[model samples]
Target chain A: MTDTAIEAADLTLAYGRRREPALRGCSFRLATGRVCALVGPNGAGKSTLLALAAGLLRPTSGRLAVLGTTPAAARPRVAYVAQDKPLHPGLSVAETLRLGAELNAGSWDAALAAQVAADGELDPGARVRSLSGGQRTRLALALALGKRAELLLLDEPMADLDPLARNRLMGTLMAEAAEHGTTVVMSSHIIGELADACDHLLLVSGGRVRLGGGIDDLVHAHALVTGTGRVADLARHTVVESRATGRGLTALIRTDGPVDPAWDVEEPSLEELLLAHLRAPDAPALITPGTTPTRAVAA
Target chain B: MVEYRIDRRSGVATYLQIVQQTRQALRLGLLEPGDKLPTAREVVEATAVNPNTVLKAYRELEREGLVEARRGLGTFVRRSLGGAPADTPLHGELLEWATRARAAGLDREDTAALFAAVLEEKFPQPHAAPEQAVPQPQPPPERTLPQPQSVPHGTTTEGDPA
Candidate 1:
């Protein structure tokens, strides 16, 4: 088994006692050296989990570890780029890299930082305040890349980038991660380009992990079943989302047992699966690998 | 270097698609031994996929003895597939049979069923699963399961008062 880069067991974090915990009983192990995509709708505890993993926030109760140690211990080796891609407005492009090098101490790679500057087409002398939003994001990423951290936590790194810039940045980050064997955990919209870049998936909803595992294993286990009439036999499978398809009903379901022969079962597209989970916030979870995936009645 | 393209939404997995594309290239004479596969960066630039994904595909190919990853250099094709081209003698023979099947007024699905039955009869493997041995490449246009004989049971169950 691969070592977990991050682990949370019975973890709960709440900003205020009266407010719903941003995260509740959140538990999942992200394997080392894999690019993982964290997906959920707004206010679904995604950002809270990332913040917790970054040591920026402390849990109210329960345990969380990054790289087999507490997040505080892992902080120096972990690089987190926030959703806003924050940067010092007065610093020039060159100065930002220099600041990054200083902050990261001995781990900084000045050459990689220079190459990113060139690729982003930012003049070393250009001030951050003068750069466009996309340019600032590129510079923010350049600093993150220069750190050469063991774990890179990115929050929607491509949100502001154009398609071409997004592709180039993803390519650079992926190649760099591969060359360095760094683990990357990035959060993105439920439907984002380059999701295929992530090999593992962690879906959080309703303040808990709805499902988490290798992308292939999850996709292969679930199916899109379509059939006429309510499939009473399928009442036992963990139905995620279902709707009337004019004449028949189409439903996405997670199952280890046999499906009723009445339905035409096909593998679900990645988008279909994600939308299913997002559409049904209370969709029964398949969190722990060995637990029987909870079944739901036709809805 | 060979370019890798993948469908992010298709039933096929991206890495599996990469593996299949590499194998297809080998069979098509497009990729040969000693040719370097696209670097992880090249693949990411073209496909915008996870770099680890490309590396995983390469590792799979290596495990299958099709390619080898050299440290600090790049992954290389280990050997030629040395198999027949995509269009084998069997393909030409199938085309000839298709013409006869059409003249005989067999519908698309009827032709497939006939072919499946013949294949099952002539080349049945002792240990293969029923579906694999029959090799139905397409999902049946109509529902293939819930055999007609079993329909009455479901109908009766529906008729039962809950």
Candidate 2:
């Protein structure tokens, strides 16, 4: 089996000529067996990227690979849950699961699907049109998880669920990853919740990958230092964002080596790191060593 | 089996919480030698934490020689931490002292601070240097208290004494 789950080399996509491109020359890689949190602001092309990886949208330029092959070729092995969660309105919840089973006959995991559906207390006989948004999310996730796909591409999967449901479903997702080593890529706006459930992260903004790598590695790559000095004093390191505090200037820097002892340095929390980069999108993007694309793309 | 309670806002790392809870269980006799710790899948299924975090906690336990992982079975407790259980005379004395402290109008935070001060005096941090061991610089009373570890909030009545 291929170790790389998803790899993109300078991938770009646009809806029309008038509007700006949704994804602008994006490139990154995700290793297998990772539960990665794809986080960004609204209109940040998160959905577009997930669609491209799901084989629903073709990139306007550059290469996109899923599961060591073209997205289209890996469709059967990848599960994609759109934000809308389009399901047959007339079909009952049980019928929907049956359909999923038929579509993925050999790989279908009926017990797991049923259990997930049961955990949400979704009535099997209830029609899809009559289900609430959160219930619909539960059913969609049931189908996606039951498909036993090697890679799961989910867009805002927990948006509609209540707190209890979100926690239960997230637990189920983590269990699946533990048991089968599934590579899950889920996009969500809740950074706090994602921080617990994900070991890796992708922070996309302004149609580019601003931060991509293991959450710990990316967080450790930068330091939040507060000291009495001008911004120029940090010339040796790459400063992502800096602001003047009451006592001195506090800046987040991608450390090249040991920081000077005069400065009080501390590791930035995941939230701090992401916020600093998000506030300054022009900051030099950091893709940790293994998360960088394997193939060379022409600049 | 020990169920890990994760406090996302506690500022303590998630894995360390698991490790602390396991150690707590061992000291309380809730987990004994030859007992099986919950599998990583089981822990993640309940806590929703990253599976790797569970594995990392287990590896730390293994490294400390407190637990051992069998190939096909699961992680088993190698030995329980030797400590005075809840029913011990020392525990009773502490509980009585806490009750008296409560009766004496000592609020929970005040009681915790006083207890922590005594603990720090009796058992100084092993890594502290001679100069640093003289006495902590007192800025504010709150800053003098030991930094909270994985203490679950609202459970100060348990006489944990940690």
Q: Tell me, by lDDT, which candidate is best.
A: 2
Over the stretch B96-122, how does candidate 1's per-residue lDDT look in tens digits? 999899999999999999999987787
Best by DockQ: 2
Give residue B57's lDDT in candidate 2 (0 to 100): 84
Fnat scores for every prediction: 0.48, 0.63
Q: What are the TM-scores, per candidate, against the unseen true structure?
A: 0.77, 0.89
What interface RMSD does each of the candidate structures achieve? Answer: 4.7, 7.8
| Off by more than 4 A, model 2 | A296-299, B96-106, B117-162
Residue B104 lDDT, candidate 1, scale 0-100: 98
For residues A196-250, could you state the per-residue lDDT of candidate 2 as single tens digits?
8999999998789989999988887888888899889889999999999997999
Tens-place lDDT digits, model 1, residues A145-253: 8888888898888889888888788878778766777899888874557467787888888789987887767777788888895755567877888888989899888
lDDT at A280 for candidate 1? 86
